[model samples]
Target: MHLSEMTPEVDTHTHTVLSGHAWSTLTENCLAAKRRGMKGLCLTEHAPAIEGGAPSFIPHSQQMLPDTVEGIRVYRGIEANILDHENHLDVPPEYLRLCEWAIASIHSHMFPEKAKKTENTETYLAMLRDPYIDILGHADDPSVPCDFEALAEEASRQGKLLELNNNSTTAHRPGSLPSLKEYILCCKRRRQRVCVASDAHFHAMVGNVRPLMTLLEELDFPPELIVNLTQEGFEGYLRERITRLKNLH
Candidate 1:
């Protein structure tokens, strides 16, 4: 599907006011997504990895969110921080269970430079093996330094989606495009699916996929393999994911 033909670019990874560092409120984020013609936006706040950063282990109360926003579904989710050596997140299983979806990712602050590249890949692979994880956000980030082929294969095997993070490509981390491209190619070769995320920290950044789209074109990626192209297909994928996660518990 061409970018113009793609309806409702669903941003599966986004941060809201709940994320201590994010600048936008839930309402503002939703409004921004609406303006961008997004069918839905998942508010994935940071699962704290550092001290005094939204409390590393506490989960947000889901009852605090409105069920819907401007006719678009607002999924309560979190970008759970991947700790070193272990695939453990700061938030507990009960907290993760409250979310409609969950994205596991490696943030620079969480994984220090001294960490082993192979061990980092192992951590991600273990997370992918876990049925609770729906998506692996920004798995190709060079700072974390993981083997792209292995991660992509595990994602394909487990039916978990890989993320093409646009923000990381643009400015968050420079010189990582090669790694991201490798992930894209690996996913393509493995016949795995992926989602393009803005990984937005503010409202204006919500639903922005220009960077990711351009990269996909440059890589000659198949649009049909991305999950956000159609609502029916996306939901079907989500349903299967939920069932898989539930069975794990």
Candidate 2:
């Protein structure tokens, strides 16, 4: 499907100035989401592990934001830092429990040592099995390498969504191209679900995942496996997540 014809129902990973390093305010971010025809948007500020990430109070107070902003569903979440190979996250479990969803990532800036493929694979597997994390962010970033096939298999088994970040091409993360293609191909083989996100640091970039979507089309990736392609599909994804969370609690 064409990008214009199939805009993702939710731009699942977005950020605001509360993240400190990002430029846009939360209102600006929400306005951009509404203008882009997105049915939902998530303000997933970077958790405190990063130098300029949000303070602890941010996630705890996110309940104050309305459930919907400018007619778009808004979710308060965090891009939590993966502190080690054993799936430890920067945000505490109680703090994580306050958000609607969470995306766990391995940031080389936080842990500069390059991990072996086995170590990286284990990290992804452990994070996938965690109860709080709903999505895995930018596993394609080359600086933090992993065994894509192994991660994809585990992600599939755990019902977690692996991200195809648009900013991986336009922004930092230069060495992402080869691994991105490989991981998507791996997901295709395993029939795993994936989410296309802008990983937007600014308001204008929200819902701007056209490049990733175009790549998906070129690969002839199965549309049914992409959860955010349509509103109903995304709501169904949310319903499934809710069920899982309820069972966890």
Candidate 3:
């Protein structure tokens, strides 16, 4: 249950050209995941976040894709923007219903008001409570601050995973190291589940979670708490996720 000499079997968060700001195609992303020995990756396109992000119809339309591509299991998914403090998502209900998996994230642009730290905490807690959302992407972002302890407690209660975004470990999210460490520590202390994601915007970066893994290794984070560390672990989580979606109203 350690990070050394081990890698997550699935890259839970990734972007394709369809996300508007990313540089890779779905095919390229899949190949990269396969090369990295990933059993699969979630093809999560952004919606209503970037200026030219994927259309609202994109999520439901993803059903056209095969379950597996390039020998890698492809989970049709969307990274929906959390538009406001009311817990509203940019992707509408109809499209949301078709998403095989979904990530709800707060981008800087999504909440220009940048509500108070307490409000952001509430917003995140609301997201974690959502049955449709499998994970909350990059809550460590300094821009949208949340109380890490509160997040850890709520995520544990909800039985959902919190994202450890590798993108934040790099210069992409400046000054994020402290917050990311706090997030890891809180989750570890609470014995909460998590998923490490590359958050790759390019083909070559798929499954590129080494930096975050290094951080986890340094913290001695528990591997059993990470849902994607092994194929069986991830697949088991997926089955639970699919069942959760089906049982939702």
lDDT of each: 0.78, 0.82, 0.85
Q: Measured by TM-score, how close is model 3 to the native structure?
A: 0.95
Q: Candidate 1 has what TM-score?
A: 0.92
How does candidate 2 score on lDDT?
Answer: 0.82
lDDT of 1 by residue, 1-249 (tens): 566334345778888766788889888888998887777888788877754456553445666767778766787788888776766777677777767788988777657742578888888899988777888888787777888888878888888888888876787778888888888889888878988888888999888877778778777787889887666667778788788766876
Q: Give the per-residue Cα lDDT of candidate 3 at 98.
A: 80
Over 1-249, each residue of candidate 3 has an lDDT whose tens digit, in order, gives 457566688888888888778998888998988887889898888876557887554664687888888999998888888888889988876676687678999888657867578988999899888887888999999888879899888887887889999988899888999989999999999899999999889998898888899999999998889988877888787787778777875
Specify the poorest-scoring 10-residue window by lDDT in model 1.
Answer: 50-59
Q: How far is candidate 3 from the true structure (C-alpha RMSD, Å)?
A: 1.5
- TM-scores for the candidates: 0.92, 0.94, 0.95
Tens digit of per-residue lDDT, candidate 2, span 1-249: 464357787888998888889999878887888887878887898888788677654674788788888888887788998888767888887787777778998888777554667787788889888878888899888888788888888888888889889877665677777778888888888899988899888899898887777778777888889888776877787777778878977
Native-to-model Cα distance after best TM-score fit, residue 149 in candidate 2, in Å:
0.9
- Winner by lDDT: 3
> Candidate 3 — which residues are off by over 4 angstroms?
none
Choose 1 or 3, whichever is better by TM-score: 3
After superposing all C-alphas onto the true structure, candidate 2 shows an RMSD in angstroms of: 1.5
From the highest lDDT down, the ranking of the candidates is 3, 2, 1
